[model samples]
Target: AQTVTQSQPEMSVQEAETVTLSCTYDTSESDYYLFWYKQPPSRQMILVIRQEAYKQQNATENRFSVNFQKAAKSFSLKISDSQLGDAAMYFCACRSGSARQLTFGSGTQLTVLP
Candidate 1:
């Protein structure tokens, strides 16, 4: 069984700054995918970034990026030039290549301070 852990329960960032959210997982599978999903007040989970275990390059999308350390089983999300709209509950998730289900962390409440 695999599990995701998020040490920080909450995080805050001033507008236009950067914030990094940490995540680590325990898994025996060698092939899998890690993801960062953002759920705002609306409660819709949106995929922020994803990293494949076999890939060396970290995944990035616009202002969002991930620091994926496969060896250490660490996958963290970095939000740059943070906007107020970016405030949300972020969850770190993992899905094995053979499984369709996602095992998620408790979640980190990200507050963007003005």
Candidate 2:
């Protein structure tokens, strides 16, 4: 069974500063995808960034980026110039090519301190 682990239960970042949320996973399959999903107070799950295992290049989207260490099976999210709007419960997820379901890690709550 594949599992995602988020060691941090909560994280805070000053407005305009940067923060990184750590995530590690255990998977037997080599072909898989990692994702960072943000669930704000509204409870809607939004895709922040995604990284494919085969790609050596880390995935980035605007203020969001991932540090993907494939060998260690670690994938972390880095938010640059953090904003209050970025406050949310972030979940790290993984999906193998053969599975339709995503295995999610315990969420890390990100608070943007003003």
What does candidate 1's lDDT look like per residue over 48-110, in tens digits?
898999999999999999999988999999999999999999999999988899999999999
Q: What's model 2's TM-score? A: 0.98
Model 1: per-residue Cα lDDT at residue 101: 93
Per-candidate Cα lDDT values, in order, are 0.95, 0.96
lDDT of 1 at 14: 100
Q: Which segments of model 1 are wrong by more than 4 Å?
A: none
TM per candidate comes to 0.98, 0.98
Residue 101, model 1: Cα distance from true site in angstroms: 0.8
Candidate 2 lDDT by residue in tens digits, 1-114: 899999999999999999999999999998999999999997799999999999999999999999999989999999999999999999999999789999999999999999
CA shift of 26, model 2, Å: 0.8
- Total colliding residue pairs, candidate 1: 0
**Candidate 2, run of 10 with poorest lDDT:** 42-51
